[model samples]
Target: MGQRMKPFIILFLNLLLCQSILAPPPPVDYGDSELSLKDVEQLLELYDYEDGLTIDEPQVEIGTLSPIRHKAAIPEPEHTNIFSAEHELPPQKPLPRLPLPPDALGPQTQRGLPTCLLCTCLITTVYCDDLKLEYVPPLPKNTTHFYGRYNKIKRINKNDFANLNKLKKIDVTASQIAEVDEDAFRELPHLEELVIRENQLRQLPELPSTMTLIDASDNKLGRTAIKNEAFKDMDNLQYLYLADNKLDHIPVPLPHSLRALHLQNNNIQEMHEDTFCNSKDMSYIRKGLEDIRLDGNPINLSKTPNAYMCLLRLPTGRLI
Candidate 1:
């Protein structure tokens, strides 16, 4: 009986030891602490001595954000308009009128033959016809206008019209006048018009500053240079006729006041860019000038690239 009781007591002691080892510890209350999957798996493995533990798969969902909405929180970029930029201002008013001299209406003199009879005489006009004089006549004192056509006058002398301060017009057209002296019309300050057409002149003489018109067509000017200090100051000059001449290169730096320039039937081959640079002021006058006749001249428009036809417009005749 004693041996059987000893076996039962040993079995009971083994069951009590197994229960003490398998019991879990008291749960600790850690406030607001996130537990990782690895930590939870470690805790379950530490207590799973009799049964194995398995974990489920974790679920995750993702969303995308817009880049435009992120930029809207920041300040917008600066903007500007590109159309309102300019460098110069427009012209405001018109130019003033040119002022004439106080003594612009004075009388003029003539210098030539004394025997030349005055065929006809008006208030300010004089006509001498069929005069076979070899030279210009010494005009009467205070003679403002003179007409000496159909005569055989050859050359013009010095101080010819010295005292003719009011000489506004002179007609020597259709005469046999050949040569003109250097000081032909020196002191005629108010002389405006000169008619020397259909003559045998080889070149032009020194003209005056107040000459507004020059009718020098059908002359014999061959290879002549129209150079004189008097031409530089002719601000009132408008008409210039160099037709039927033998000019090869047209004169450069034309007067700014010239409204009509005729170079027809000349032997001009080429023209420079500065040829019409000085005539830019004629556009302010009436009609603003039109016509540039290069018909008779031998010019290459391709070689002369900068030529502007607007600078050759004239008031009286075409720009030939």
Candidate 2:
């Protein structure tokens, strides 16, 4: 009625202005397409959108590293008493063979080595002097004083002092000893000093009344190298050094413990008025018979003036 609804409301407002000007000009945001709810809760808080369904962890190959097992050690029971004493260490006892030294079983040396290793065995004195020694080197049975002087010892064999029972001083002086074995010092029962002086001795063997000093001086002791009552049982004869010997006499019945009777330069001519007194005891006064060395013999002490009464002196040669 106002124009028949005014052209139908103007064709419904021209069909809403042609559907807002043809509909396709709405997409260029330039604000980069618009999200904001804090960018969709920061993109749904950077995606963990769990609606449930995951299953993925298996990548490891940064060149191999996966071996970790461990856990199994428990075995020590071989007899397990821990510490109650197994004690099996007491079987070691085989050690006792050591008894050889008394100077290693004595005697030896002619290069067999052991006379205390070539002479000078001091503990019981064994010198073996001037060792060009031609003999007598086997000594050490507790040899007590034995000086084999200037050796080249020629003969003395009676086992050269057989078993030296503690021989006491036997100086084989100036050796080249011309024979000695009348049992060589007849079994020395502790012989006391027998210096076989300047050797080449003609006799003088059978000795050993435990003689106390009998130096058979410068040898070749003639007159049968004295063996008859040789100082008659030496009664501990004190020093009888037959000087430069080749005696002619005066080895009388001398041992009244004779003091010093060195018959000098022997070949003594004579002397026997009972030799050293006691001429049938004219009150017997041979007081230890003092030093009587008839000088360089060929005697003539005024032809034995009573053979020195009982010697207290006065018998030193040529009293003519």
Candidate 3:
């Protein structure tokens, strides 16, 4: 019996010793313990055997995981606003009509002789017939006047008065003259008067400073304003005849030496208040001017009251 008990005891002791060695040494409380290779292996094996857990396939929908659609949906462009438009402007008016004189009918006339059989010979005069002559040659060196009335000359050409330094007068009335070149009176430095009435002149040609009188009536001068400087240099100009022309206003700053001014049958409607501002000096030399014909201008009464009043006060009186 003792021997049997001894054998049981030995077996029990052996079993106790094995248990103590296999048990994990009472878990070391190392706050955050690092596991050894054996512990990690044990944990993995335990997790593998623990559950019937299966991984789910990632859930996917039609629009999920796509970039956010932030852009605005595009619509078609409108065409109504591009087809609306507007209109345009108009044009200007035309100028008035004016006639010209007839042409010279014969050869160039001699400087000092009667230009035609019908003309009378005079010491200082020239005369020519109505023919289609191109130019009128210069007057003779000794000639002092010219008379080429009723001729068909179109222009007063170069050297037309070349050596007529003593020329004092010219009479080219009733001609077919459309234009006068600036050089037409170039050499006539002492010319005192010019008579170019009864022609179809649309505008007055420039005159020289030596001229004292001008007779340019019965022509078509369409409502043109005479520049003050036009006669400023003509210190000798005393008489000016602008009747039967188309003037609408009195030219300002008239010549200081002017003793008479004729403006009959004009289209004149107004007179500038200062038109005679410079004429005060002329009264002393000529004892006041002779006439200011405003007869045919019906509008002058109302449009130029001051001028009418001033004219009435003149020493020689007015003509309206």
Candidate 4:
């Protein structure tokens, strides 16, 4: 093997000598102490070493390439554009108000509105108080409790509550009502409470038999204003307040169901023994008549010491 390698080594030396002769001179700066770039390249060429392997360059198919494109621009909305100062929507007209239908009754309001528009009407209650009204407004058919307090009403017309059969209570307190027709509340079959206090009434109109409470206090009612038998037929009369008035004597023949009778601050100076208790019937005991106010009257309770004999409690007045 050494003999065969001797000839190849000699051939390599000869090729290197021939290359050194054929190549141009190297740069003068290249030092003889170190190998130069040209010397190394020549040595590699002479050896001709076989490369182990090579990676192939990737090939691209130009025929499958897609063209560049751009999307269409969307138009800007006038109301949504932020770059422009005048981007605003046009003004729209408001809807018109509707008119009332025909067949409406009673007087029109100052603004041509209905009576309910002037007053407030809940389910079955009408509140016409503190409205500065001059007359009673026409109430709804289902009105059960009507309040016309703190108004300027001068009179109570008979037809004010004519066909209102469902009316139960009428409160006209603190008004300027001077006159009430005879039948103002006469036909109201279901009227239970009537409050006409703090008014200018000189006479109380005839009330229905269903009355349970009658408050005519702070008025101008005299002794004759209330009929002697006004409360005789009222079997359900319970509370009667006629205080701060001009009553002269205790109204006689009170109903058996009378529980509270308030006639304070009146002109009452005398009271019979039977005003509250029956002397003829010694067994009669008014157990239900427990509250009676005669405090502010001119009557001397000592004059009729036996007046309240059958009462559950003594009358509240000046006893001495």
Best by TM-score: 4
Give Cα distance to truth, residue 316, candidate 4, Å: 0.7
What's the number of clashes in each of the models? Answer: 13, 0, 13, 0
**Local accuracy of candidate 4 as per-residue lDDT tens digits, 207-233:** 999999999999999978998788989
* Deviation (Å) of 89 in candidate 1: 85
Alpha-carbon lDDT of model 1: 0.62
Model 3: what TM-score? 0.55
TM-score of every model?
A: 0.55, 0.32, 0.55, 0.67
Model 3: residues with Cα > 4 Å off, grouped in runs: 1-121, 129-134, 225-228, 278-286, 302-305, 308-320
Clashing pairs in 2: none
Which of candidates 2 and 4 is the stronger one according to TM-score?
4
Model 2 segments beyond 4 Å from truth? Answer: 1-99, 105-113, 116-141, 145-167, 175-191, 199-211, 219-235, 245-255, 259-281, 285-298, 308-320
Candidate 4 at residue 250, lDDT? 84
On residues 1-320, what C-alpha lDDT tens digit does candidate 1 reach at each position? 54454444334335433444687423323358754435545654655523231433222347787566444466678786554457445767888988855323322323322322334556666677666655555555567788888888776666666677778888888778787777777567778899988888887777777888887877877765566343567777778777777777665555667767777777877777546543454343333335345557666545654455344342222243
